[model samples]
Target: MIDEATARERVVSTADRLFYAHGVQAVGMDTVRAESGVSLKRIYALFPSKDDLVLAVLRHRTNQWNTGIAGAVADAVTPRDKVLAIFDFLAAWFREDSFRGCAFINVFGELGGGSNRVAEAVRAQKASFQCRVAELVRAAGGPGYLAPQLVLLAEGAQTTAAISQDPDTAAHARAAAETLIRCALGDSENAPTV
Candidate 1:
């Protein structure tokens, strides 16, 4: 007998990859079963429903995605630099061949209106990410408004980069963010005199 825990992990892992690569609405349970090699009975035994599997994948991907972005900018000399490093990190992610934009944004576009759970899960991820950005902004000695504005820039950069298939969108956003941060911090010695 396949262990239930093992089966659950396999299903969620498979679901995450497929659902992220293909929108959740597009991938069916059978495809998951075929790709995972987990029997349908075992899949149902673990998740009982497609919705459940999707939730598991969203939660898992949210954690993984947030962790990855955080990890990418963990090594900065200053808080402002750390915030700037986020753009650099995004450029790297955008360049990946497998890059498919933000999973939360993709799923929300597909099912946010019909699925409350998906909307909430995606909302939670955005809120959590904003909170992290707020912390970084605080460390950087930015004003209160800077946090939300910075998150906005980050989100806008993500979507623009994906839509344009331009990895340098992050760099453009970074320039704007630099101006905002300096404005917030009242530090413009580095700002161009032009």
Candidate 2:
């Protein structure tokens, strides 16, 4: 028999794949059980409810994604490099055959503006990403306004790349972001010194 910890991990792993491949609402508890090979009773015993399970899955995915972004940014030697790493990371993601767009954005879009546990998780994750970008911008000596503009452009680029199947759109967005950073730092040509 599988231990409780292993069973829980299997359940979360299965749910994460399903949620990313299919919309959150499209996946059901039964599907999780079927894929995980865990009994329904066991799943319920661990998760309590589908919403609880969804939150767990979201949290797991969020941690993994945050770690990846942090790792990518850590390799950069400067704040400007770190900011540009966001685009580079997204570009690599677009190259993946399994790429299905941002899972949080997709779930939020599917849920349609509701205040629930899942929505709260999504909002927090988004805010965290924005905050990280803002921090990087400040470290790069960009003015306060530059962070929000870069965040918006980054989000827009993700949406466009996901919808239009045009990864190159990120390049345009990156150029725009660089210009914003330059303007924020009172430099017309070069990026800010950090």
Candidate 3:
């Protein structure tokens, strides 16, 4: 028998992949068990209900989002570049074959009406991301209002890329973000070369 941590990881990861590829409402616990190679009993032990599993997958997706954004920002030379790095990361992610748009948005759209927990989880994830952007904007000397505007650009890029199947959507968003950043900071020279 696998330990609880390993079993939980397998279930969450498998469910996350399946739910992202398909819709959350379409995938079931049995599929999670088959994909994860974990017994149904074990899955139930770890996550007593489908809602529990869905929440776990959402948390895992949040971690992935944070880690990817952090890695991209870490390579930037300036705080302003760090803000731009977010779009760079999105561009790369949009180009990936497995790209299915923002998981939080998808899940929230799918289950947000019926599942308050899912809605709250997605809301919290988005709020946390916006807060992170706000911090970056503050560090870059951007105005208080710039954070949500930048986030909207990023959010719109994800949806557009997913629907349009165009990886360059991120580049377009980046250009707009740069313009906004320049306007907010009142310095075109501060914008990155990207």
Candidate 4:
């Protein structure tokens, strides 16, 4: 028999896979229950409602992505390298055959601009990501312009990868990002101040 922790984990894992692969609107509670091998009652007992479950799944995904990106950026010797790490991270993720797209972006599209807890979570996560990138750019001596431009380029690369089914899109974006970083830093050889 699965323990309570195991059962909750199973439900979360199943929901993450299903929700990320299919839009949040497309996957029903029954599908999650069936896939998780947990009864509907058990799922409701754990999540309370579909909205709660959606929040849990989104939170889980957000945490996972945060950890992964942080790990990738942590070892960088300079802030410039840290900024480039974002593209490297995306390129590695795009190599996976099962890569669907950015989960938050997909969920936002599925929600269609309605104000809800899930929508708010998506917005918060995206804002946090942009802020993080901006911080790295600022540390690399970039003015205010670098952050928003880098954010736009990253978003564009993500959309292009999703639409074109081209994993190399990230590589191309990384090249462009390098040029931007050089412009921001003013000198390729100068180590960032902080």
Best by lDDT: 3
Write the candidate numbers in order of decreasing lDDT: 3, 4, 1, 2
TM-scores for all predictions: 0.92, 0.91, 0.97, 0.92
> In the order shown, what is each candidate's alpha-carbon RMSD?
2.2, 2.5, 1.0, 2.7
Better of 1 and 3 by TM-score: 3
Cα shift from native, residue 78, model 3 (Å) = 0.9
The TM-score obtained by model 1 is 0.92
- Candidate 3 C-alpha lDDT tens digits along 86-183: 99999999999999999999998999999999999999999999999999999999999999999999999999999999999999999999889888
Worst 10 residues of 4 by lDDT: 185-194
Q: For model 2, state the Cα shift of residue 19 in Å.
A: 1.5
lDDT of 4 by residue, 1-194 (tens): 78889988899999999988887889999999999999998999999988788788888988988997898899677888899888888898888887888888887788737648878999899899899998998787788888888888888888889889998999888888888777767765654332
- CA deviation > 4 Å runs, candidate 2: 112-115, 188-194
- Model 3 residue 106 lDDT? 95
Q: What is candidate 2's lDDT per residue for 109-168, written digit by digit as tens? A: 876375477789899988999999989988887777888898898888878888888888
Candidate 3 has its poorest 10 consecutive residues by lDDT at: 185-194
| Candidate 1 lDDT by residue in tens digits, 14-95 | 9988987888989999999999989998899888888888889888887787787788668766778887777777878889
